[model samples]
Target chain A: MKVLEQFEFLDDVRRMDARQVIYQFLNFCMIVASALMIWKGLMVITESESPIVVVLSGSMEPAFYRGDLLLLTNHHDEPIRAGEIVVFKIKGRDIPIVHRVIKLHEKEDGTTKFLTKGDNNRVDDRGLYAPGQLWLKREDVVGRARGFLPYVGIVTILMNDYPQLKYAVLGCLGIYVLIHRETN
Target chain B: MAVLTFMCFLSTYYNDDLADVNIKVGSVQVKNVADFTTTRERKDLAIINNLGVKVDLSQVFNWNVKEIFLYLTAEYSSDVNALNQVVLWDKIVMREDAQRIDIPSVDPEYYFFDDSKGLIGNENVTLTLSWNVIPNAGRLPRVQGLGSTTVKLPSTYAHSSGRI
Candidate 1:
């Protein structure tokens, strides 16, 4: 009898009205959905697979440093030029590189080949290329750099550096929103 | 709201600065003056020199100009004043509109010439080439405001007797 009474009391306190529960759930979902929409919008406008990137290393130092944010756009019709900095992904590598184009070779079939070298490095990126591959094709390029923000990617870096802190922050935000009970 | 706006503005400002030029050249040279055909079958002149001395700009297809000027300045250790005089003479000759020469190309016509030439055979030879780019009105992406090359020629080329 005592156990049954305790269960009923606990259930009463824990239960929330359906409307209120639905309202909070919808609000959270909307916020997440909007973020995804904006990201997709950026992808379309930039015409790139990844429109935004964060500098994870200092390979492009003096021009771009670690924790910097980069904006990129790729238009297929536009020809790539030498001296311009571009961001590209190598196969099997999770991250991309920002480097300057040092050489370009156009073939008779209208295809183009390119070689890249970082500003701070002593040599070209031949070593970084895929096994036995010497040059980068147009498809390898993710996007050409249109612009960049300095050090604004520090938040991302911090989150990655401190995985525990990232979880703690997310936990705190979730708790705060749940307890505040504000209707928007 | 203020904080969000500030963040947005700061990000944009830094983004612009990050797009600045990052090319470095310890030396540059322009050579191999010969007519050739491009993949497009356009008549173009091939100048093979080492931009690869520091870095090569060969892959860049959206060149703004057809003709590029190669400015040369040579210095002699014996006479500093003579070096200045040579540069001054070359500047005068280069400034004359008639001195500009046309360099043919497949896509667009270009030219190359010395805007200023200084002494040869003393100490060092410094050359600057400013390309005459076809105006694209900034529509082209990442062009970095046309192109310029500076070359330091071999000390032997600075000799007064080396002129052709």
Candidate 2:
């Protein structure tokens, strides 16, 4: 009975004025829109579609661990060098891989191809590439890691792993925002 | 936490430097091997022996540093591609481990293969020592050591049967 009492605030919504209800709903939308605008701004500034990424695997252990936050930047004009950590996506693969560049072959015309291998792994990532694809081109590079933060992305990873937890948190936040009245 | 991490980043951002390194390549031997991983065609695989590396990386260690990923890359220009860089050897130096590297002579850890026969008689091949300083929370600065050495590769291929 006590657990269900939190939802009793639904009655308060019916009692609130129409203008006040609309004002709170608009405030919620503004918060979401601002978050989206910030993300899009980061994409433009970093030149990477996804400027931030979470390390989901331990392939680059001792450097990046699971749930670590990585800041990525993709400068199309800059050349990728050896020993740099790069995040790349393979064709048909949904998840991107973060690895170190061990080999680089650049042509005179500014076209370059490179091979990657995880620092923790024994072999190169040739097997992970698309079938018959020996090298990764500049187009395949999602971004190059520039900054790192430890254990900041655990919340995102946990939400992805557990669907119910994500829904519960989102629902609670929505209800709290809708019922919260600003006292002038 | 964010302020502390930012302070840690600023403290080591410019202070970290990798210098006083000496690298020597004694000999290079190229062999023709089947490229099973990629093209599936026979490619030139070059092996460097008696590699001498001496460096003091203890100064790179700090509270903000987690680990150092050190590697020796061979950079050269080939006919097929203008710029070619290949990593021949690498090592991970944890904060607790010894930071000084004093190898007298050792073979490379990884196979140095060329897409074509570019490794043969490459006189301008340069070997440089570089490392990535992994931080607890900050920029991943890559620093190249001060010293590097270039060695010429043998024009003829070594017999694949004989182990060098």
The per-model lDDT (C-alpha) reads 0.48, 0.89
User: Judged by DockQ cut-offs, is candidate 1 incorrect, acceptable, medium or high?
Assistant: incorrect
Q: After superposition, how far is residue B34 of candidate 2 from its true place, in Å?
A: 3.5
Estimated TM-score for each candidate: 0.54, 0.93
Show the lowest summed lDDT stretch of 10 residues, model 2 chain B: B155-164
Show where candidate 1 strays beyond 4 Å: A1-16, B1-164
**Per-model i-RMS:** 16.0, 0.8
Q: List the residue pairs that clash in candidate 2.
A: none
Residue A108 error, candidate 2, Å: 0.9
- How would you encode candidate 2's per-residue C-alpha lDDT over B75-104 as one tens digit per residue? 999888899999989999999988898988
- Write model 1 residue lDDT over B1-164, tens digit each, in one string: 54663555443332211111121234323322221211222121112132211112232222221211221212122221222101100111112133323222112112221212222222243222222111111211322323323334433331122221
